[model samples]
Target: MPSSPNLYVYHRGEIIPLEKAFLHISDLAVQRGYGIFDFFKIINGIPLFLDDYLARFYESARLMHLPVLLTPDELKKVLYRLMAQNQIPQSGIKMVLTGGYSEDGYTPAAPNLLITQQPITLLTAAQVQQGIQVITYSYIRDLAEAKTINYSTGIRLQPHMRAQGAQDILYHQNGIITECPRSNLFIVTHDNQVITPKKDVLKGITRKNVLEVAHQKYATVEGVVTLTDLAQAKEAFTTSTTKQILPVVQVDDQVIGNGKPGTVTLDLWQDLLSLEKQQALVRV
Candidate 1:
C-alpha cells in the first residue's frame, strides 16, 4: 500500500508512490523540455469533463509526436484507481506525457505518461465578487493551441506581475489580446456583445461551457480580440478549469467598467458555477 504523505501516481502501467516516480536525465522531456500536459478538476469525487480533457491530452501527445501507450478507456481505469487511492474530494488531476529517454538527446522515444492528483484551493464567492486586477504583457505563447509543459515566459514574469499588483498576466501579440497565462479572456462590449479570442489560444473546456451558457442570453463571438476592444468593453472576465469564472475589474491603470465586477461578469460567474454543480450531481 502507498503510505502516508505519498499520493498515488499513475505511471506507465501501474499506480505507485509519488516519490517512486522517475524519469531518466537523458529523456528529451528533461534535456530538451519536450513534453505536453493537461489538467482537469474533480468535484465531489467526480472528474469534471474527463472526456474532453482526455481528448485534449491525446491531441497534445499527437501534436508533439509522443505516442500514448494506453487507450482512453485504459487511462480512465487507471485514473479512477489513482483517485480512489488518493481520496482527494476536491482536487485536480494533472496528466503529463514526456518525450521518452533519448539516446541522441533530441528525438522522442517511447513516451512516458504520468498522472497525479493534488488538492486545490478554490476562490470564495466573496473573492469573486471583489474581482482582480491584471497587467498586460506584450508576448505570445509558443504552440498556442497545445497544452505544452513550457511556461517559462509566464513563470519568468511572476515578479513583473507582482510588482504591478496584478493577479495574472494577459498576453498580447502587438495590440491583439491572446489570453491570460492560465486562463482565457472574455470581454463584453459596450453594446453588450461577449467576445473571446479564437486564434492562438488554448480552447479551454470552461471557456467552451461559458460560451454555451452565454449564448442563451447574450450575443457571443469567438473571434479576434484586441486591446482596443478590451479598452472599450463594459465588462471583462476570465475562465479556466480552476478559476471557473472570475471578473477582471482592472487592466493596468485602466478601470474596467467603473472599477467593479460588472453585472454581466457576475451573472456569468453564477451561471457557470450552477452548471458545474448540476453536472457534478449528474456525473457523480
Candidate 2:
C-alpha cells in the first residue's frame, strides 16, 4: 500500500494529523461500504478544476442520501488550508463523505467528511506515447453514475488484469461498452467521428473537457459503443482526472488502429495538455 504523507487531514470539523484520522470499525462506511468520494489534482499548489469536482461530490452525496455538512465555500476554504498546511505543490486531493457510525451498522446516519492529500503518480512519456492495453469484462456497477467508495469488483479483478498483461479493465454490459474501471473510454471512427458511451457511465470532468476540445475540431457523439465499434475504430483513448487523455492501443486481442495511438487520439491528448497549461496560467 502507498503511504500517506505525515501531513494534516481534514476530519470531522478540524484538521488532524494523518496518522490520527481514523474511523471506528462500526462506522457505516467500514461496515457497509456506504460512501461517496471525489478526487482531483492539485497542480503547483493550485486545486485544478476544484469547483467542478466539488459539484460532482455534492451531487454524489445527495444521490446517495448522505448529508454533506459543509457548504461549497466552507469546503473550499478547508481544501485551501489543507493544501497550505501540506505544502505539496503537485498532489491528489480526495474528499470522502462516509456514512457515520450507525446504531445497527446498517442504517445511514450523520455523515463524516474526510479530506486527504497524497503524492501524485504521473504517467511516463513512454506510457503516453505507446498507449496501454485493457481487457474487457462483462459487468456493470450498481449506481454506476455515483463515485461511490465501492471498488470491490475492480479490486478483485486485479490479478486477472495483470495476468492478461493489461493495465486496466474496460467494463461493458451485454454488448455495449460502458467505461473503464477508473476512466472513461472514447473511440474515433474511420469517418473521423469521436464517440463515447452516453449513459450508464460516470460523466467524468476530464471527459467533459475532452468533448469540449473535440467539439472545437471534430464531430463528437455520445451513445453506445460496442465491441464491433472498437474493432473498427481508427483510434481509441480513455480520459480521467489523473490520467488525462491516454491512448488505447489494444483491447483484449484486437489491436486498435494499427496497434498504436491514432492521429485523433494524439491531437486530443495535445489539446488536453494545452488546456491544462491554460488552466494553470489562469490559476497563476
Candidate 3:
C-alpha cells in the first residue's frame, strides 16, 4: 500500500493511530537500518497470496534474527482486525519487523512489529500495453534473500534512473542479471525459453507464481540470466507485489522485442490476472 486515509496501524500488538505509531529513538531500525518488511494487496477484503507472503515474512525474520511477537495464525488475526478497523476493502498491508530499541543503539534486542494498511493502484490495460523501460545497474543486495530495510543503493540510484527516462533499475552483477530494485527480472529467450535468475535474489511471491503459470505453456528455467541474454531476448518482464506482471519493453537504451509488449508477456499477464481472480474468489 502507498497511502491511505484509514489512518490506523497495528503497532506492538495494539491498534493505534498511524501518527502515533512511532518507535524509540534508540531503535536499531532508526539508527542502523535493521528491519524487514513484506507487502501484500487485498482485493475486495481478500488478501492476495497471504500464505506465501507470510512464509517469506517469517523466513526473513529468521534470517535477520528478529523474533516475531506473534505466531503466523495470531498475526493473521491481527491483520484482519486491522483491516476491519480501517474499513478499506481494496488496499494493501505492510508488515514491518524492526530491530528492537537498543540502549547502545547497536545491539539487537526484542523486535518491534508494525502493520499498516494503505492504497494501491493496479496497472490499466493501456499502461500494460505500453510497458516500461529500465536501466541496468551492476550490483547485488547484501542479504539477497531477506526483504530487509536496507534499500540505500536502489533509492540513491532512483534519480539517475529517472534522469535517463527509465522507470526502474535492473541490477546485474558481473555479466549475470539478478533482479531489479524491488522486483524480479524475467526474459523470454530467442529459443522461447522463459528464464530468470536462480541465485542471489529474493524469491518474490509474484515471481514464484509467474514461473508456475509460465511453466504451463513455456519452458520456464530458473537459471542464470546474463546481460547478453537480456540484450538478445525476445521478450522481458518484471514481477512484484505491486507490479504484478509488467512488461519490460526497453532495457537501458536498447528496445526489447520491437519496443512493445510481446505476445508472450501479455499472455502471461492475463493468465496471472486470472489466477489472482481465482485466488480472491477462493479466499472469499
Q: Candidate 2: give the clashing pairs.
A: none
Local distance difference test, candidate 2? 0.90
In the order shown, the candidates' Cα RMSDs to the true structure are 2.0, 1.2, 1.5
Best lDDT among the predictions, by candidate number: 3
List ranges where model 2 is wrong by over 4 Å.
1-5
Q: So what's the TM-score on candidate 2?
A: 0.97
TM-score per model over all chains: 0.96, 0.97, 0.97
Error of model 1, residue 270, in angstroms: 0.7
Candidate 1 vs 3: which has more TM-score: 3
Residue-pair clash count for candidate 1: 0
Please say which candidate is ahead in lDDT: 2 or 3.
Answer: 3
lDDT of 3 by residue, 1-284 (tens): 33445479999879998877778898899999999999999987789889999999999999999999899999999998898888887788999999989889899989999898887788889988889999999999988999998999899998899899999999999989999989999999877889999999999999999999999999999999998899899999999878888999999879997998888988999999999888888753
lDDT of 2 by residue, 21-134 (tens): 888887899999999999999776787777889999999998899989988998998998999899988899999999998989999888999999897977776789989999
For 1-284, candidate 1 gives per-residue lDDT tens digits of 33448688888768998888777898888998899999999999899878989999989888887889999998888898999999998999999999988889988888888888888888998989888899999988888888999988899999988999999989999899999989999999887888999999998999999998999999999999988889878989999999888899999988888888899888888889888888787753
